[model samples]
Target: MHKNKNIKAITSFPALKGRLKQLTLCALSGALLLSVSACSEQASQTPEQAKADFEAAYNSISTERLKNDIRVLSSDEFEGRLPTTEGETKTLDFLTAGFTEAGFKPGNGDSFFQQVDLMQITADPDMTLRIGENEFVYKVNMVASSKREVPSIELSESPIVFLGYGVNAPEYDWNDYDQVDVSGKTVIVLVNDPGFAAADSGKFQGSTMTYYGRWSYKYEEASRQGADAVFIVHETAPASYGWSVVANSWSGPQYGLVSPDQGQSRVKVEGWLSRDAAIKVFADAGLDFDQEKEKALQGPYSQALDLSASVTVNNSIEKSKSYNVFASLPGSELPDEHIIYTAHWDHLGKDETKDGDQIYNGAHDNATGTAAIIEMARAFASLEVAPKRTISMLVVTAEEQGLLGSKYYAENPIIPLDKTVANINMDAMNILGPTKDVSVVGMGKSELESYLEKAATNQGRVLTQEDRPEAGYYYRSDHFSFAKLGVPALYAKGGSQPINDEIAQYRKRMNVIVTGCYHQVCDQFRETWNFEGITEDTQLLFEVGYDLANTSDWPQWNATSEFQR
Candidate 1:
């Protein structure tokens, strides 16, 4: 959902929030140039010109309609749009009505909903973690969870191992796990990568983060090592979020992609420890935590720590149900092939314990995106002739719980993967007015960039590469669920190029949103909010899908992309 520059640097999207699963942000701008080279040669105009002709129709997507959708969806009446609650019923009904009004059919083969079976586990109070003689209080000193469907997970006095960056990249000749067996230990790893500390572009893609730096990768690697637990050390600078984010995330019910074996393959304990707590643990073991951390960034510094830790987690879990909204505008020429648009409709729901306003009211966090997708559905249906490839719009649930709904859709796609053309995902929509460039989260990963570039040129705007590769925004979104299965996906945000002399103001806006609004109760919409940016980005995306729907060409991941597999 969001990306950061690197652990040490704050370049593009630095303050981007990492929610329960890092739900993401962004937007774009510019105007198309029109020319009259020949008064009599209208048919010979360029493809750009052809799209310019249709620009008016694309612009027909009124801001009033967009505002209306956001206003209604994010309203307190919906109860923050949580899943398996009254919110789910109201949201589903609203979406189904919108799709039906737009002349779309149920994409789930005779049903407007796609069933996703999930298990919700709420961590009970009094969770305990002990390191040597020091006991780390839950939420205050440590936080943990297990994906496995069990009432409790208890690890007795597990040995701690220090894994440098916890990465095993053969291409980079880096294997932090070498020369040691971590079969039954807890791996203590740093956030981000060594390249971030060195500020050298040559080291693990320099400041831009690769998949290896993501926390998800750390846990996966731990599972591979047959470790009982994985604890990622959280530093404000490197992690791009404060301790509060972790505390809030780990305090509640967490959901996972329910496995056939009830996540039997996942690690028993995955958690985070505050930097201060990690430092204390090292000092108690007679090691200088700072010196050890410095060695971690110096390259190839993996060793076993002399610390022993114990973890215990008890959960009050209940089985729950959620639905993925799938509706389609069937293509005229090749209805079987499809172009999909996705945006998650679920937020943190409502938190009654929090003081002041308890409603998370994710107006901009995702109501903007969810509303925008439905608006696009309306536009596609109103077209004089249907697009060549079917346009499927998906409003998924439980993205806040780690892209669960999207993952389910990818694993159990209503349409076969082979026939799916491409996917375009919209996270938080741009609210910072118009700009000169559009931000593509993974610009060079696939041939879809060319299509996006073409559309940008048609609108007289340039493409901006994702500024925070370190944040792993590309892997954080719902689109990633499709990309892992070989589908070329474009997950992007509005560009940073502010129009007029508003660069400073734009930065200020992003800072406020990043620091305060994300996943917080203050994320509600404003009456004075400028939605033109969201409108422009939506239209640009519509044009991209419109082009792909009408063309026979298929988008492919670049040869260098890891997802090419």
Candidate 2:
């Protein structure tokens, strides 16, 4: 129910920073000379001995252990592992114990916990939106929130402008706001980019949603554009999810890092309007929604609508602290450099309004990822010869809350980002079974794919692109946080194609749960679930990390990648 008394927390950044300096010095000093010497000896071993060492350590990733961890973490007793809740206490305790048992030293100085200050903003649902003369109810036709960290957000009769996709990508030679000034006005944008609408036209990765298509990017772009408010018209196909997801996800308590400005530079209000509601709103302004959308797909477009909108959101703000759990196996030679592995431990928590099952036990959503990271740590620790570069496991908090935890850690890193070799992120892992291939999300973004290909080959498998690249899986996970800062990140997992016909049938049944149980109460752990796929995937992660850890390679982003440093 509570953290072990042995566990300690690092309360100040100055102290944490000093500890980081101390750790770096320790890595380079005489203290680790013996460790480095041992690694040098291990590195010079015969090929057969090295292979045996790898095999023995790789086999330590257990499917049974993964399953057990998932069951325990996803149980009702954990209360969905929400940050700043009782669940967080239990989750942190579990992670600290797991890392200690696995022989990792505290990654942050003398403590395993790096405190992340967070602000939780729960928007009052009893809100209304008036676009022109048309009124829309909250969560019925629209869902809204503010990042401004204020008591209330209000837009009074703000002029509306259609700013197609709300993208400002100069590299794409596109900027919707280039011709229009949306400062102090409400901007309405379509979900996703023109790529989704015309995939074959070779416009921005063709249906594979670029960062420009992401709602978060849109909001950020709008804030930079000085827009008072921004609303994205939600179409299920383009958004990669239905309106229900938007409503449910946006309606809940949102967590953000405690900022100095309290999000003063952000747009006053950010929201989603149902497609039907958007259509009606456009029609009310005497604009044909389809025709306008078509114009948007062709090129940069914007139009001042003959209407204005009004809305007020009263926020119930609560400032609290969360954490990013860190466990490190200091490398033999390059302990100062890090191969960071990340997974979010926080979920949707519970919804008391639900009749029967109130707890949203996010078993598949993240419990699997959390378990995999712990196992990966265990495997690395079991190795007779530690890696040349430190392998650090960061079980971040509040991922479901807009990747706040990872974002915080990335911006304020314990191990310097420049010194961080590469990031390997695991979120909802495969539950169906082993596959002949692993699906690499945003496959072409990094050189890490080469390492992954080699690792997968060892398993007699191949690496392939994810099935739904249009979903923008790359930008949706914790890896994106590191990637945003130019760190090459790999987010790949088991493909949909099962290894055998028997597992293929099992895949069909598992697909229902995987697809439907996202962020729902039905996302609880089931004994019938298969762990072979995730286990193999975990081992593959180990292989790649092991290789990176043993070598002096610093993985780089592809030259064409937006994140290239």
Candidate 3:
């Protein structure tokens, strides 16, 4: 359904030779002197030209178009764009049509749609938990479900094991599962790390949350160890958010890629237990939760309690088809190599609770990101000179469903991973006015930082590292899907500056926006939004892509980065 004219590939010359050739050609044609004279004459008019050009392009960006897209995507009509639903069909059709109108070729050779088979699981709350004669109510304590359809295995009634942080980090010399055979037992693990609960707070990353602390890693590690069920005790401070957030998150329709071969590489059941419910389990096991917390802060500790817990989980898994929309502008030269721009088009569909509004429009969370991708595609298409390397624009699905769309693409890439230069991901963009700095979330992880620095400098803007690395934002977005495979990714945000007052005021404003409207339905397009930041950010993004597209060199991970080996 998506198609664009395939432009002829261009030959890539060495950077220095390319510049020299252009200069020589200009000089031989006597255009260099004329260009210089014209530049001198139009010196004062350059700013006007730049402003006019940018405004014209910016004006072409229809807020109405964005609203139209958001209204449909978020409306009750789309049913929240859930995968495999009518919503998904409508969403994909809209994106496919948009890409076609934007003049992009089918990214996957001849297909605009990348088929991602998925399994949709809906859990029944009536499942019972039984440990020997002791039984606990499932609804109040935990919610369990499996990705597998016919995973025939009895609930393990073996003793529960408390694996400190449940991490296997070689760098930190930490292994919670060390010397323990948790073959078929349930593992009760702490949400975050010891450093998060430490008194000094400067020990490990100190509340900054290492990868070991993430719930995803915990689940993955447990599943790898062949644990029957992994229960992560949720706490506000250590987990970085309240249990209500977790409850709401897990209650949603869960999604995962359907194995092409239908082979099983996933756990039977994985779920979370409320902190209060976990405390009751510990109490029944004659283990003190407070004591464990206090001792864990003091030093390393691991224990396998003889307390055996069992549960019978009944869930239905259905196979469904989700889509990843791909569109690209072919390179003039080195078309095999690619530079990918990604943004997720999915959000938490409709939630009836928490302020009466049912639609999670996600206008700012991702609608802005999706809109930005379209605009970028248009800009790249408008360029007179095609990029040297292929430019792939990927608007993925189900980002709100735990980065499933991006994850599938990363694992089964249409283009080989080795030829992929770098992934530039746009999540929530700044709808506020422009600032003087641009913030890189996972800064110093790759050579992409250098490229961004160059782009920022060109725009008279400064590049900054994230002020709050403790947020672990690097691991939260779709970029992490690429990063996990050693692909370099850059997740940058619009920066903040003291436009009229102290920098603290600017930061406060940013925090309010992030915490308040970030995931809420109120993230709608506003007339008061100054597109200065969007314009500057988009231009910087273009420059980054341009540098990558023009050069033949591949971007590498920084030497000190853990991903680089």
Candidate 4:
């Protein structure tokens, strides 16, 4: 018998009162009925038995084991787990060992590793920008594009065009590229969509950023137009984060696909400039940066300013190799078909600036997520009845580096695309506390919603929409890579409301975890971590994978979804 005393609630608050009452009544009623239904008392189990089985599996997930793994992975010794470093070897070895111990067979036959060839471009920190004798150093104001390391590129005194949102969506009948030729010059644009500015705002989906509004889209569009360079002006509200975050994020070594079939990205240089620095650049050219930004926000606006600027970026490029660890549990009936569970194993690596502390040990960001998959593998392996389809447990690399691992996997899948049913991705699990609902990041975008609804229902939970859609989190994760290829991918939700607490306070605490610990050193493990929520989340995910693995149904894309058509 499992000990109930070990499963005490971590905190006591008011919001859990209703949920506790409901759970108690349901359990009691269920137990009584289950007791009566047993024709032979020895042959039947009570409702508590079922719940207890789930809880035992949940509680069996040792937070200490998770913490120990994280402690080593994130410790300075691991060197931030950056690809092409000693840490990569250590991380991969650790993951493979864990999978082997969990009884998962080699996913890629004869090997547990998937070799990903990549190009690493490390740019010089001392890049110089000069616009007709008006010069500004790189770090102080602007950063160059990640595409290539050009020692020096001259920009002929060309006109600077202001394009609204810089998006072209024929479906929405909106195009920032309409009536504008940005060839041979730089284009200035805003971050996110106009809806973000006013909610009911612009020609584009008001505050919600369309694909065109994404910075990556803007750079691609500029490249297609044969523009010299692209500069995106950064603001917190519109961009969803501060300039410091962007600067620190892009300053490190970046990764890109190194396949024979990959097409060239258009723009030679693509990057961002701080609002203050942009103001100075505009001022030097005798143009008003604020006015230009405001005009760019309005629809169908286009203007050319003679802001002749020249930038010289000096950097070194190197090619390196990364690995995506894979393991599988083959199904009984449809052995070839698969349902993938993905979690990124890489983090920011090490930053020497933080005194003696260095390793990024992505515990909550993904180590927790990775561990969840391992536990799920254990659960599925324990089932008496084997699934009808194969289950692939994928730990991708370079997610923090820009979803390179997943993107690589999508382009070159070990399993054919058509046979792959759904990609269930776990980026960061909720370590906070249990809540009334599980939040879906990109809610209502696909048929995966229906699948999640069924899974949540089984756990006595409900599905909820993302709390901050403006953040554009759906486009930020490894799942988006698979989604881009028309694969139905599900990113599972973590605990939001505490098992016993005020909903508002729980929300506040949740935000703190996302903002403060998300990409920081403070994300390390704790002795006080209840792991109750982790256990619940892990069990819920196993149920989802089990359902997908056993059922013959193919999860489809929603009709309204952009990927469906």
> Best candidate per lDDT, number?
2
Q: Write the per-residue lDDT of candidate 3 for residues 221-307, one digit (tens) a residue.
A: 888887777878888877777766766566534666676544245555677777777777777778888787676555556776778
Q: Residues 1-565, candidate 4: write the lDDT tens digits.
A: 0000001112222221232111110124445532111011224335576455545544466655655665566666766666656667677777777776655777777577787776655666776666556666665667775475344445556567767677766655667789788888888777887667767654545555555567877887888887878888888888888877777656655556674633244565677877887777777667787787677666656666566666655555656677898888767668789999998887776666668655566677777787777777766654333466888898998787678899999999999889999998887777666666788887777777777788788778888877777777778889988988989988767645555655446557656655666666677755545555666677677777767876789988765455665
Worst 10 residues of 4 by lDDT: 1-10
Q: Model 1 off-target regions past 4 Å?
A: 1-57, 178-180, 283-287, 298-301, 352-357, 466-469, 501-515
| C-alpha RMSD by candidate, in order | 9.9, 5.0, 9.8, 11.7
lDDT scores of the candidates, listed in order: 0.79, 0.85, 0.68, 0.69
Off by over 4 Å in 3: 1-82, 85-87, 128-135, 151-153, 199-204, 260-264, 294-301, 348-359, 498-520, 559-562
Prediction-by-prediction clash tally:
11, 0, 3, 8
Residue pairs in collision within model 4 = 74-361, 80-349, 195-206, 195-207, 196-207, 223-267, 434-497, 435-497
**Best-performing candidate as measured by TM-score:** 2
Tens digits of lDDT, candidate 1, 170-272: 7676888877688878889998877777765467666666677778889998898888889999988777678987887667767666679887787788999
What is the model-wide C-alpha lDDT for candidate 2?
0.85
Model 2 ranges with Cα > 4 A deviation:
1-46, 284-286, 351-358, 512-515
Assess every candidate by TM-score. 0.84, 0.89, 0.80, 0.80
RMSD in Å for model 1: 9.9
User: Model 3: what TM-score?
Assistant: 0.80
Evaluated at residue 112, the lDDT of candidate 2 is 87
Better of 1 and 2 by TM-score: 2
Worst 10 residues of 3 by lDDT: 1-10
lDDT of 4: 0.69
